[model samples]
Target: MTVIVREFQPADAAAAVRVRRAAAPYTVTTPASMVNEHRAAPPARRYLMLVAERDGEVVGYANAGLAYESSEPGQAFATPLVDPAHRGHGVGGALLGTAEEYLAGLGAREVYTWVLDAPECRAFAGARGYRPTRTLRYQRLDLASAALPEPPDVLPPGVELRTAADFAADPRPVYAADVEVTADEPTDIPFGPVDYEEWLADTWNDPLLDRELTAVVLVDGAVAAFSAAHTDGEGRYVSAMTGTLRAHRGRGLATLAKAESLRRARAAGCVEAYTSNDSENGPMLAINRRFGYEPCATEVRHVRTLG
Candidate 1:
């Protein structure tokens, strides 16, 4: 079998989505999301979406982009996913090779990729000069089986609950809150200030994002906690990001927003939901555990310094 790697075209949208879904089923994605990721990519990001074709069928894909949102420079990510059935055929290696060359050409000195925590998966990255950095988990919740905490009758003083849709005219406040919370998230590296315009283009306007299903907690009429929700055309919802501002920490607002979001999600016919967290994040993990979410899968973040 001959495998050829090439840039993705409009016609390859469905194939790309299929390859991604088959390779990583934890997140919900669509052809539109793939296209928008490229179209909305900033110049500094240098984003590229590539696919591997064998016998005229796409069996693998790689998404490479500079970490433009990070305060630091020369940071990039090239996440390559190959169909499990085609793992030994070198499709993954080829995809990584192309992704590295692209990122290097775009001025990236350090690249980070998430590899499954398995002997085979680790060896694949090791052979390519990647080193283990940290581990993250993909968690799942059976909305039908889990017993969620009851919603409080009334929020604490000066605290209110809302949704992302409530800030239709001006989402900058939400964007600011997101930037602050994301900066504090546990990671190998820190993300500095966020660009509101870029956040609006990539996150706020994402096609899969469901603002109505998203839950937000407001304190004194300002954004404090939020749980971003995503859904496929099917009945599955995922919590993309759930965080509370530092000032609101220890108040259980994160849990409040997440529980409300899950309740709204199930009421909207969503039967299952998913979320991910850094293995070292105890606070978030405890919040998730309280909601009966269990570990379903794990992926390790690997880093490689380019020479």
Candidate 2:
């Protein structure tokens, strides 16, 4: 096979989305989403989405960049996905190599990637100097079958539910709330405060983000909690990120937002919902459990420090 790894082109969006679906079935991806990612990537992150071509057909892709969201600089990530049918043909290895080289050129020292909890995936990362760090479980809920928790008839005083669309005119409040919640999320490495412009580009403006399906909870006229939702032109709903601000902790705001989001998703004809959580995030795991979400897949966060 003639293997060529190079920078991704807008024309390859369909092929890239296909490769992602083939490589990771649990994740929902679309061509439009791929295009949005490329256009919205911040320069400081040195973001590069690369594709592996074999005989003129894309067989794999890699998302590489510095972890600009991290307070600790020099952190980077390079996630490579190869079509299952084209695996073990050096496509993945080549993509990883190309991605690492590009990220290193952009001043990345430590690279992190998520390796699926499969023996082969572990071996592949280990062979490339990447070692297992922590595991995250991908939970799935059957919106068509599983019984979702009922939304409370009455939210606590001064609290009201809304959608991301409600803040379209001015989203800085949502941005501020996101920064606070993201800072408290469980992860292998700590992340810095959020960048509003970056958030607007990479997150708020993401094509897959369904503002209508995204449920938000406002307290005292302020964004308190939200369940950012995404869909891939299908019935699957993904909780891209769900969080509550510090001031709203222990108020069941997160649960309220997510529950309402899921309910809305079901009403919109969505048949399934998915979300991932770090193993150490007990509170989130418990909340997900309460939503009838079941562990469907797991992936381990791997790190490789290059000299």
Candidate 3:
């Protein structure tokens, strides 16, 4: 079967989302988010999402870019996803080849990608010069059956629970909180301080992110801890990111924000909630378990070095 890989078009949003869902089921993705990401991609990153077609239908897709935001040099990525039914054909390999060629041309000397923790996936990456590095596990929570925690009626002396909606007028504060939390999360490589403009254009304006569903904890009138949320119109919600500043580490603020956000999600009719955690993050893993989240899938991070 002949497979063709080409730059993604705006009209391919729906098919691209389907391919992603088939390949990485736990991650949050929607047609609108796909379009937003592809359109708002920063020029510095040299970002591209390529789609592979077989028999005139989209069979796979790839996300490729230079990690321009990383403090370290030579970092980049090209993640490919192929529909299960279309696998074993040349689709995946073709898409991956195009992705790597694009990244390498952009001066990338090192590239990273996530492969599902399975024999075939490992062997596939290993055959292509990728080496296994770390593991990440996806967790699932049934919002429909969960006895979610209630929002606290009373607050800790200086803490207040709020929503992202409250900061709509000026989201720089939320952006400040996000960079703090993101800098602390485990990463495949070290990232530089985030670009506020990029965050505003891509993340802040992401269509899937639900401002009211996102729960925030404010301390002394400043954004402290928060849970970011994204939802597909079809009753599926994702715990996009949750974080607390290093100064507020042990205050249980992350837990409080996530709990409140999950409660809000269920109330808003989301039935399936999902999140991923690095295997080494015991603290966050335990916190998620406490919320009755169960392990669903495991993925391994793979890296390849180019000449």
The lDDT leader among the candidates is 3
lDDT of 3 by residue, 1-307 (tens): 7899999998999999999999888887889999999999988988999999998999899999988888888899988899999989988889889999888888899999999998988898999999999999999998999987777788899999999999999999999989988888888899877788999888899999999999999999989899999999889999989989888889999999999999999989999999999998888899999999999999999999986
Clashing pairs in 3: none
Candidate 1 Cα deviation (angstroms), residue 189? 2.9
Give the top-scoring candidate (TM-score).
3
lDDT of 1 by residue, 130-211 (tens): 9999999999999866687778997789989899999889988889888888888888766777577888888999888999
TM-score of 3: 0.98
Question: How big is the positional error of residue 276 in model 2, measured in Å on the Cα after superposition?
Answer: 0.4
Tens-place lDDT per residue, model 2, 29-107, is: 8999999899999888888999999999999999999888777888999999999899899999999999888888878
The best-first sequence of candidates by lDDT reads: 3, 2, 1
Off by over 4 Å in 3: none
Reference-based TM-score of each model: 0.97, 0.97, 0.98
Cα deviation at 284, candidate 1, in Å, is: 0.4
Worst 10 residues of 2 by lDDT: 186-195
Instruction: Give model 2 RMSD, 1 decimal.
Output: 1.2
